[model samples]
Target chain A: MEQLLQQLVNGITVGSVYALVALGYTMVYGILRLINFAHGEMFMLGSYFALTLIVSTRVGVLQLVPNVLLGLLLVFLFSMGLVSTVGVVVERVAYRPLRRSTRLAPIVSALGASLFIQNAVMLTYGTQYQVFPEGLLPTTVWRVFGVEVTLMRVIVLAISLGLMAALYAFVQKTPLGTAIRATALDHDAARLMGIDVDRIILTVFLIGPALGAAGGIMVGLYYRQINFTMGWTYGLKAFTAAIMGGIGNIPGAMVGGLLLGILETLGAGYISTGWKDAFAFVILIAILILRPTGLLGERVAEKT
Target chain B: MSRSRGIALFLLAIMIVGVGGCAQPKAEEKKPAAPAEPIKIGVQGPISGQWAFEGEGIARAVNLVAEQVNEKGGVLGRKIQVIQGDDKSDPKESALVAQKMVAEKVIAVVGSYASSLTEPASAIYDEAGIVHITPSSTATKLTTKGYKRFFRTCFLDDRQGLFAAEYFSKKGYKNLAVIHDNTTYAKGLAEWTKKYLEERGVKVVFFDAITPGEKDFTPTLTKVKAANPDAIYFTGYFPEGGLLCKQAKELKIQALFSGGNAVNNPEFVKIAGLDAAKGAIVTTEPLPGDLPYPEAKQFMEDYKKKYGDYPKSIWVILAADAMRLIVTAMEKTGSAEPAKIAEYLHTQVKDFPGISGPIIGFDEKGDRLGTIHKAYVVDDRGEFVPAP
Candidate 1:
């Protein structure tokens, strides 16, 4: 029972990270109806950005700043901002140009963008893995309800939940959110109704990557290691989370991310860790078979 | 006489003496004749891919050895030249590299790091009757393939697997879980470990194969947990191993975890987190770092001076040693001919002292003979501290 409880804790921590990354996947897909493959690389960008900030500022200039939390906040903001610019540029260069070409064209472009970004990262940083800097975050273990949780895992969950809530408010209540929803419902109709569809799509890309970057930064802090190849694995899992919740629904993505995390963690803990990957895939397959549309997704009629 | 005329006269006298000296070497006191062409030693490895670090280290170490040999009046008066080619760490690429080296007429080929790469490439070398010595290949089947030309300066994975299993049994870790990457090298090592441990009356709770390069390992860990094994042995590289350790810790499966040489990396400590990696044991070829051998310290010093960082693996020194052996054998045989050098290597390579340990370049089957393995635990800071 203790072993089961322990694995459950471990799974949930990993799942939380997956959920955070999946939120970006779900939100971008929700608003734009495009799977932002480069979102994973965006997460990678966030990590490198945090790494850069940590190295340049904390190690170099921020020696004068006595408070650790202040240093962390600065590092986090810089990472998010850097990744935001990259996200915007990726959309402008890769996705926007193919806005009207065809659905296949944009999908292909996103994959190319992903490859391009990963290689660029490889070239810029190096092919070898870099260990995350030490002492940037607390590594203390916290005991909760007879279950062990690390300070890093708790931070990852709390920060991710906070961002998800903020994203929900931004999409549902704000004018920009209204514009995004209007455009997502009907691109042509939204355009006719005086909503700038292109701007909305751009906004979606911007918001998604920024959130992804935040998640990425959190991952580096939580895992204490960063490499060029990290984004693809977590990104794939997050995509699975988005699909499980209904790909284009914001709330669904959140639900999907959390549920997938818990399920994967609990499943791996209780059932079999060897079957963890298979179990995650089984959920996707089961969902696809049982409900062609995801939990929150509805079938849209094909335009002839 | 004027200054210019006197200088010209002196130069003319020196030129006559220089010409006289060139023609003075006669029958008895003459040095051996320099060969018409340089003796080419082929250096094959992945110089530009994932395993490029190891390849570059191998090539650099070999070239350094070649440089030292040439400075001491060259090998058999013919300068030893290194002809390098990138294997790209792929089997097909490695084979092509071998064929290219053979076509170039190299006296001997030196690398192809991983056993997978060496396995196919060695066949090409064997067919061509070209001598190939792998500095780092550790697969058991390479020597077993009846390739008379093939040799490695390290123990095969099976041997190390047995060593790890024995260590576990001696420590009384009776209930064990075996997880291996589903590769020929990893699986072979894991299988050998399982068989050996079982033979010693240890209860093998689980033996599982995980796919290589998969990111999430929670499911596998969960299953290992289900078996409730006292210890776990993983046969995979640090990338997945680190993540597995991290995930395993999170799942609260506190079984003592160990791995093969693949996990003997600094990246493992950082990736797995220090707390997670604590108490994790790994069995690998004896590194020059811990060995008290005299040459080990010298190589570490020279290597550190040449490259601004510590060498990644202990086998790199052995790689360099193999290069020295080939050049020395060529000189001893008084020829750069492949057949002569290969024959000399077999006959004269007994009890050769190298950086790793005593290396007999050829056993009965022409495989490198070495018997040194070390066990280590990752400290809190991630450095591999030799086990007490």
Candidate 2:
């Protein structure tokens, strides 16, 4: 029972990050019906961007940080802002031209963009994995009923939930949200209704990657290690999470990410750690077989 | 009529191959004669990619040895000429590097560092009857392929596993939890270590592998924590090993954390942080940073003087050890022919001293003989201090 509880804690922590990254893939799929394959790399960019800000060679950025909490908040917002800008440029240069082409073209473009970004980071930063600077967040751990709870775990969970809540509110409660949803439902109809479909899609590309970047920074802080090629694995898991949760459903991605994390962690803890990924995929296959559309169904646009 | 046409086409294809074979020059084998041109020694390793520093290290080390040998006196009345073959630390590229070395007719070749990269290159060199000595690749299966000319100055992974098992027992640790990353090298080491421990009647309470590229091992460590072993031995590369150490400390696991040679890296301490890394014991063959013999001090100074920096890691000096063996064999045989050099070293060489240690030599399996494994504990200063 203690073991189960411990793994649940571990799973939920990992799942939160997966959920954040999964949102990018889900939202992009929701609107454009295009899987943003480059979404994972944006998570990597977020970590690297934050790292550069914290420790630039020309000047020690740590000395510039005024206080721990404010410094971390600033780092998170600043890096996510930078990554979102990069995301917009990527959509403008790479995906925008292929928007009218066959669906396969944009996916291939996203993949190419992923490769280009991954390699560019490798060339710029070199291949050595960098450690996240310490003292940004409290590293204290407390034991409750044989389960270790680190302070950072609570903070990460809070940040992810906060972002998700804000995003959910923005999408469901605002006129801009309805306009975005309308554009997702039918591009021609939305254009006729003066929705500015191009701007809406651009907004999605911006929002999705920024969320992924935030996930990246969160993961880097919690894990305390970041590397250039981390995206391939993190991206794979996030894509799996998005699909499992019903690819185009926003809320489904959230539940799926957390669920997949818990399941895989329990699977590794109980069944066999070596076959953890195999176990996760096997469960995914079972879920998909039972529900072809996904857990919640791929809800592209809800009929108002 | 169609069958006859098919037969005619097949006959033509054979005739074309026969013509092509006839047009090519026959593969040449050197006969021992009066030396004229410089002796060609090939250096094969990653000149690019993630482990490029290791490849570059092998080159610098080999060249330094060659310079030392030539300064004393040219081998077999011929100056040693070093030819580099960049494998790019890739198995596909490793084959091309081997082919290039064979084409250059190098008397012996050193390197293609990682086990995956070296295995392919070793096959090519074996076929060409050119001696290839890897400096640091430790996969147990590499030497079992029955290649006459393939040798390694480094001990096999099983040897490392044995050294680790003995250490655990000597330290009075009976129950152990062993973790691996499921990589070929790590898994092999873990299995062998488990076997050795079981032979000593030590209970392996938990045995499993963690997924690579994972940032968290809390669940896996939690499971191991439940098992409540005397110590936890992680048989993986430093990246995951370092994280496991950090997380294990966070969980406040009472068991000591230990690992084999792959975790014996400065980067291990850097990743784990000084507080978490302290007291972690690592089994490693002597690194350039921890050279056991007096000659190593001079080697370091000379290397720094020539290269403008100390070697990238332990691999540089290990490559130098391989180069010195080849040179010694050539000097003893009084011949630059590869066959003679390989034969003399296999039969006659014993207790050869290397810069890395007091004595370095190979057994029948082309594995380095004698137990050279040193256990080092990460001290508070973040340096790997030799554990007494």
Candidate 3:
């Protein structure tokens, strides 16, 4: 039972990152209806950027703060903001050109962009895996029901959940988010209503990529390591989560990410961990077979 | 009806045919006349991607050896030329590279760092009648596959696992938790150590195999801490192993963590941070810095001079030695032919002074007759200090 609880904690922490990153996938799909395959590389670049900044600047200023929490907050904000800017630029250059081309064009362009970014990083930073600087996250353990919950788990869970809530509020409350939803539902109608669909699409890319960047930074901090190839498996899993949660459904992405994470963790503990990856995809298959639209997902008429 | 013109035309045609025949023989004669053509050797490995640095290290060492041999007035009065190809660490790609090397008619082929890439690729080289040697492939199945043409310079995972287990027992650690990457190398080492440690009454408290390339390992660390093991044994490559060490530290697991040669990479220390990597132990094939042999020191100097970076793995030295072994066997047999070289290798390598250790194999199975593990600890500065 303790093992079960620990696994649950593990699942939630990782699943939260997946949910956040998957949210980006869902949002981009929701608005532009493009897969944005380069989204994973965007996340990778975010981690790299955060790693460079935190290690070079904030980590050296340790004498200023007797407490470590303040140092971490600064690192998170600086990294997140930088990654958000990167997201906007990538969308403008890579996706904007293919917006009017054939459907296959954007898909191919996204893949090319993904490869280009991954290889560029590989060449510049080298193929060596890098670890994040230590002591930025807390390590204290709290015992609950004979299971130990470390501070890293708590932080990852809180940040992920916190980000999800913020996103929810933004989508439901903010004028910009309303424009995004309106454009997503009916781009032509939204444009006729002076919604500026292109601006909304750009905003979606910005938000989605920023979330992906946050997830990437969180992963590097949580795992304490980053590499050029680190984005592939996580990216694939997040994509699966987005689809399992009904591709374009925001809340569905959240549920799918958490469920996939929990299922994967439990499967690792109870069944063979060797098959854990297989288990993540099994949920995707099951979700596709059952409701098809996923929990909270509503099927909409196809646009001609 | 112009008989004189017909006779002149026939004589001209005969003259043209005679010149063409003379030119063809001239080409064939040049081949035999230049019997001093350099003895061609092929080197293959991942010169790109994640393992590119290691591959380039091997290539540099091989070129250094070639330069040394050529300076000494060539091998058997013939210069040695090294041809290189990149495998990119993919099995199918490795096999294709091996085929290309074989087509190039290289006397011996050296390379491929990983076991997964080497196993399939070695079979291709063996089938193509090329003598293939690996610098650092540690899979148990590689030598066991009965590929007479395939050989490796490093000890396999079982030997590495036993060395770690023995060190743990010697250090008086009773409770142990092992986490493996579920790869052929990692899983094999972990299983071997588990069996060996349990036999000696060391409590095997936790055993888990994690997926490779995953970013989060909080769940695994949580399990390891809950089990309260004395030490954490990880048998995986640097990429994941480094992260595991950092995560373990972040979780305050505080147990001794050790891994196999895969974690010997300095990148592990850099990635895990010096604090997280401190006190971590890893068993690796001997690095150049750890070499006590005079020949090894010379080889190290040559490698550093040529590559301008410290040799990445002891495998690079082995790769150089494999080239030496092939050349030595060729010299011993006094022939450049593959059949003669293989026959001579079985007899000549008994006392061959390899850079890693003495290259003494009893049979073709490739167990180095006098090689043992060199345990290393990651210091606070991230340098692998040889564990006394």
Instruction: Give residue B201's lDDT in candidate 3 (0 to 100).
Output: 83
Query: Which pairs clash in model 3?
Result: A131-B271
Runs off by more than 4 Å, candidate 2: A57-65, A188-194, A298-304, B1-132, B139-142, B295-312, B326-341, B358-361
At residue A176, candidate 1 shows an lDDT of 88
Q: Which candidate achieves the best DockQ against the true structure?
A: 2
DockQ of predicted model 2: 0.63
* Candidate 1 chain A: worst-modelled 10 consecutive residues by lDDT: A56-65
The list of candidate 3 runs beyond 4 A from truth reads A55-59, A62-79, A93-105, A137-146, A192-194, B1-152, B169-176, B191-208, B224-229, B252-255, B292-313, B316-355, B358-360, B365-367
Q: How are the candidates ranked when ordered by DockQ, highest leading?
A: 2, 3, 1
lDDT tens per residue, model 3, A153-238:
78878988999999999999999988988988998999999988878887887788788888888888776678888777778888
lDDT of 2 by residue, B263-303 (tens): 98888887787788999999887667677577788899899
In angstroms, how far off is B88's CA in candidate 2?
A: 6.9
Residues A142-205 of candidate 1: C-alpha lDDT, one tens digit per residue:
6677666777777887888888888889888999898888776777888898888778877877
Q: Sort every candidate by TM-score, greatest first.
A: 2, 1, 3
Q: In terms of DockQ, which candidate is stronger, 1 or 2?
A: 2
